[model samples]
Target: MHPDVAVDILKKAETSLVSYRDTGFADAQTSAKEICEEMNVEAALKQKRLRTTKRQFSYEAPDEPITDALKKMEFSFFNVVVDMAIESLRERTGMMSDVAKKFSVLISFSSELEKQAKDLCNTLTSGDHSDLNYDELIVEMQSFPKQWPKQNMTKLDLVFLEEKGLKEIYPNMWVALRIAVTTPVSVVSAERSFSKL
Candidate 1:
């Protein structure tokens, strides 16, 4: 793998975590340059070990060029780092993250996110006995940004403060958030528990 590709993967892995989002995660140029420094340390160690050894060089085979050895080491490091980055991205974006990305409408909404919200609604309503109404949900979702009142509305309790709750106000969103987003995990697991393995 190319060092640039490895650095890009590392950047993706680093930014995938919410904690590292604001840290810049060490730029690609710096990370690529780090390989040479690591190679220097590795070379010094090899030289020190050779000095203490009693083995002599063989005439049958030629010694590999230092540049070739460095290139090999650099490529090896790139492959390993890229693999590690892929694993980290997979591990971090778990089932819950998938659900969150799908139902992010609960947290915030914008013109850009409308398509995602519509798709989420469509996917939710595609199944049998789905509680969401795609057409209504799409219309409501389009207008939600205007009525959002955007007061860090992560919790649903505040919206449910009234006697009738959000259902009476934004019926589609209420169903989308409450029924689809909240029930998918437990509902699927519960249904599967009774099925044959």
Candidate 2:
């Protein structure tokens, strides 16, 4: 993976460092740049460890208790930090420092996944409509949710769909929308795209 992408992932992994909805995560652009650079090293180490089956126990004597050591390490520095962050996240209402710190990776992964999924789903659902009707399909895709069942959508899902321009057709309907964004048929289409692409 590119160093830029790795840095993006680390930025997301550091979710405990920023606020919800806030754009600026790091102190300065220079600091973010430095953090991204440092993340490259951490990402490399993580990937290396993942690729290798050799556990930490391999470094110790066979006579030592690996299970005990593992338990002891469970409450190590990293785990404590994570626990603290989770607690803070649970208590907060809006985006907290933790969520913002993870901005880059979260944004990157979400955008990529949504894009790929939408592309595949659209491709499969799209028929060989003539050029004259192509525009209608786009409009229908944008407005279809207006005619959908409402009342079961999550706040996050509502926020997301609104951002996608789909909610413009039925602004009030969003609160009552009981829509399942993807179906098994769409999932199969996505899988097929994965195979073809």
C-alpha local distance difference test of each model: 0.53, 0.37
Evaluate model 1: give its TM-score.
0.41
The per-prediction tally of clashing pairs is 0, 15
Q: TM-scores, in order shown?
A: 0.41, 0.18
lDDT measured at residue 92 in model 2 versus the true structure, 0 to 100: 41
Error of 1 at 181 (Å): 6.1
lDDT of 2 by residue, 20-40 (tens): 213332233346467778887
Candidate 2 residue 9 Cα shift, in angstroms, is 15
Q: Which tens-of-lDDT digit does each residue in 1-197 have in candidate 1?
A: 22223344545655664343322233443664687687764322232222334557877765544454334544566445655755665553454455656666655665556677666766676456566666676677666546554664553442452445546657767766554323323224456465221
> 93 in model 2: Cα distance from truth in Å?
18
